[model samples]
Target: MQMLDGDVVLILGGGSGLGLGVARHFISEGASVAIFEVSQTKLDALKAELGPDVLLFKGDVTSVDDLTACRQAIVDRWGRLTSLVGSQGIFDGQVPLRDVPVERVSSLFDELFHVNVLGYLLACRVFLDLLEASDGSVVLTSSVAAYAADGGGLMYTASKGAVLSAVRQLAIEFAPRVRVNGVAPGAIADSQLQGPKALGLDGVKQSDIPKEAMQEGFKRLALMPTLPTPLDYAPVYAFLASRHNKVVTGQTVLLEQGSLNRHMLSSAGVSGGIGTPLG
Candidate 1:
C-alpha cells in the first residue's frame, strides 16, 4: 500500500515552490491535499492542472479569517484532516544587517514573523483538534537560516529560529495525540524563478538575479557545490508527515548538505582554539 494512502494533507503556500513539490508527492502517494495559496491566478492554474482531486484555496496565511475559512472548507470537503505542512515564507531583500535601514528591517521582521511564525500558529491552532482526532502529524518548513546566517537576512533567520523553538514546545504540548516537527532545507531551485511572467510577484527585479551570478553564488556558498531541487526534499517531508514519524516529534530535521554545522567547527577561538576537535 502507498504510505500516505487515504491521508489528507493541507499545505500552506502550496501553489508554488517547495510546497507545490511536496503537494505533488503527497498526491502521488495516494494522499489528498488542500493547498492554501495567496495568489488567485496560481491557485486557479493549479486547480485546472491538477484537477478536482487536489483542493486549491486562494488565501493568505497571515489572515486568521482566511486561514479559518480554508480549514473549515477542508474539513467540509474531506470530513477530516490527517496532516498539515506549513511552507509559507517571505524574504526581506536579502540585505546585510548594516546596509538595511532600521525601519525597513523592522517592517520586514514584522511581516516575516506574521507570515512565518504567527501563520503557522494559527494553522496549528485551527487544525489541532482534527489532527488529534487522527493522531496525525504537522510538518513545518523551516530553513537553514535558523542555524546559519547565510540562507537569508536577519529577519528570515530569526523567524525560522522561532519556528524551530515552536516545534519543540508544540510537540511537548500536543504529545500522545498529535506530533509536531520541522524541516530545515538548504538552497533549492525554486520554480518561481522560471520567468518574469510566471507568478506576477513584485519587488524582485529580474535583472538583479542573472543565471550566471546565481550559479556563482551557489557554488561559493553551498557545501555540496550544487543546488538541490525541490523534489529532492519531498520524501523527507512525506516521511515526517506519515504515521511512521510518530517517534520523531520535537525534532528539527536539517536537509542541508552538512555545511552549516561544519563551519562552526572550522572557526577558531572555541575550546582550545583551531587544533582540537570536539571529540
Candidate 2:
C-alpha cells in the first residue's frame, strides 16, 4: 500500500541485521531511505545489495559529528526527513554480572550503553528539528531484555530498559509534533548482533552461536515453537514510521512471539497447550 510513500527516512545502523531489514521494508513501501553505519564493509555491501537508490552514510552512531554530517547530507539530498529509526546496539553475550571481571565492568558498561542507549539519544537530538518540522516519528530498536531478565546479561538488559524509558519520555516531550515509539524483538536468528569490545566479544555474531543452543534458548524463553528471522520484525518499524500511525506514541511494541507467557508455564511443558482454549 506504500504507507511511507514520499517519506524520507533515516536509519542508524541500517547496514546489516535488523536495521537492514527495516530499511528494506521502508524502501519497499516507497520511502526514500538513508542509512548511517560505522562499517565501510557493511556500507559497501548494502550499496551493492540495495542498489544505488538507497543512500548509505558511513558514520558511527555514538559520534555526534558523524550523526550531524549524515543528517546534513540527507537534508541536502532529500530536502527533509520524515522519520528517524535508531537500530544501533550491542549485545552482551548473556554474561552474568558475577561472571564479568570487576576491572572490565566499567568499560563494558560504557561501551554497550554508548552504542545502544546514547547513540539513540544523539540521533534524536541531531534530527529533532527536522522531525518536528515534518511531524515525523522515531522508532528505536529495543529488545526483550528491556522488560525481562535472561534476554541478555546485566549490561545489555539495562541499556535496553533505558531505551524503553527514553521512548516514553521523548514521546511526551515531543508530543503534538513528533511521535516516539519502539520495537522489542526477541532472539532474531540471523542478526549480526555483537557484544562489547571491553568484554572481548566485539566480533561475535548471533549466527556464531551454536544452532542447537540458540534453538534451545528460544524454546525455553518463548511460547512460540521457533525464533523469528530479522525480516519478520521489520514491518512493525515500517508501520510506526508511517504517517498513518497518528495515534500511537510512547509505546514499545513487543515482538517476542509470546515469550512473556513462558513465566506462567513450566519449561518442560512450555508450548504444549498453545492451541488450547482458556477455560
Writing each residue's lDDT as its tens digit, candidate 2 over 1-279 gives 688999999999988888988888889999999999999999987877888788899998888999889988998898899999998888888899999999999999999999999999999999999999999999998998888877789999999999999999999999989999999998887778887899898889766888788888777667785867777888889889999997899999998888787675555557656786888
Point out where model 1 deviates above 4 Å: 191-201, 205-208, 217-223, 261-279
TM-score of 2: 0.93
Steric clashes per prediction: 0, 0
List CA RMSD, all candidates.
4.9, 3.4
User: Can you tell me which runs of candidate 2 are displaced by over 4 Å?
Assistant: 263-279
TM-score of each: 0.86, 0.93
Best by TM-score: 2
Query: Cα lDDT of model 1 overall?
Result: 0.80
lDDT of 1 by residue, 197-262 (tens): 112224463234565766676665457756667778889999999987757999989987756546
Q: Score candidate 2 by lDDT.
A: 0.89
